[model samples]
Each structure stands twice: as structure tokens, then as C-alpha cells.
Target: MKDIILNFGPPEELETKRILEVRSLSYLERLERLMAIIEVSHTLNTAKIIQTKKR
Candidate 1:
């Protein structure tokens, strides 16, 4: 059996305009960095599940 996770949230497009409006030194840059971290975490989680099932 497989388990699925659901993510209910707003889309990234909403951040597009807001991100562009941010100044160079603003916290929005950190937001983008955090987004990258989130993506990496998701990839690692998926890889771990696949590796576990193969054992």
C-alpha cells in the first residue's frame, strides 16, 4: 500500500509580482531561498521512500 500526502496552499504565481516589487536587500530574497530549501526537502523525502521500498 502507498500513502499520499496532500498539500493545500496558494500558488506561486501570486508571489511573482510581489517578489519583483521587493527591494534587493529585502526579506523576499530569503523567501526565495526558503523555497529552494523546501524543494530540496521534498526531493530528499521522495528519494528516501523509494530507497526504503527497494530494500
Candidate 2:
């Protein structure tokens, strides 16, 4: 779980807290996917901040 999720909080939203089973993914594969998601999220946040600064 540590490799997949950087931060966890109390369940409030069903979509964020939903559980899924991925039986085929190796530990490394899961980490890679998590990293990809983190990168994408970071990129999106940066873009949003830049747009705000431009205003």
C-alpha cells in the first residue's frame, strides 16, 4: 500500500476510497503505475498554478 499510495485519509468520497483488486500486477509494476499517476497529477497542478499566475 505504501508503494501505491503516498497519502491516505479517512474515507469520505466513495470513488477515492473504493477498493480494487489487481491480481496480475507485480510490486514494481504497481509502483510504476503509481509514479505515472503522481507525475500526471503534478503536471496538472503546475499547469493550473501557472494559469492562475498569468491572470
Candidate 3:
């Protein structure tokens, strides 16, 4: 299992949180196929995009 934090937008607080939600969902779905389980967390750190290939 892997835990990932997705940070989007700037310091300024946005009126709606829909964008973040959509992005998070998209990431989860994509990773779900490759990973056993996928979880998304909100954080202020940089985002990491990983690539995996099956040999």
C-alpha cells in the first residue's frame, strides 16, 4: 500500500474545493489499476508523480 499527498493551488484559499477533489479522484483511479490500494491525502508539500512498468 502507498500513501500520496496531492498539493494543488497556491496559498490563497479558493472558494470551491471541487478542483482538488476531481484531481484526487483521477489520480486514485489511475493508480488503483497499478497498485493494490490507493489513498489520497491533502498536504502542502510538493507532489510526486511515479511511473511503474511491469517486466
Rank all candidate structures by their lDDT, best first, as comma-separated numbers.
2, 1, 3
How many angstroms is residue 25 displaced in model 3 relative to the true structure, after the best TM-score fit? 0.7
Task: Report the candidate with higher TM-score, 1 versus 3.
Answer: 1
Residue 46 of candidate 2: its Cα lDDT?
A: 100
Question: Stretches of candidate 1 above 4 Å error?
Answer: 1-24
CA lDDT of every candidate: 0.72, 0.74, 0.48
Model 1 pairs whose backbones collide? none
Best by lDDT: 2
> Which residue window of length 10 is worst by lDDT in model 3?
42-51
Score every model by TM-score: 0.50, 0.60, 0.20
The candidates, ranked best first by TM-score, are: 2, 1, 3
Off by over 4 Å in 2: 1-21
Q: Report the lDDT tens digits of candidate 1 across residue range 1-55.
A: 2284554556675465446645444587679767999999999999999999999
lDDT of 3: 0.48
Cα lDDT tens digits, model 2, 1-55, are 4466544666654345444444456898779889999999999999999999999
Clashing pairs in 3: none
Candidate scoring better on lDDT of 1 and 3:
1
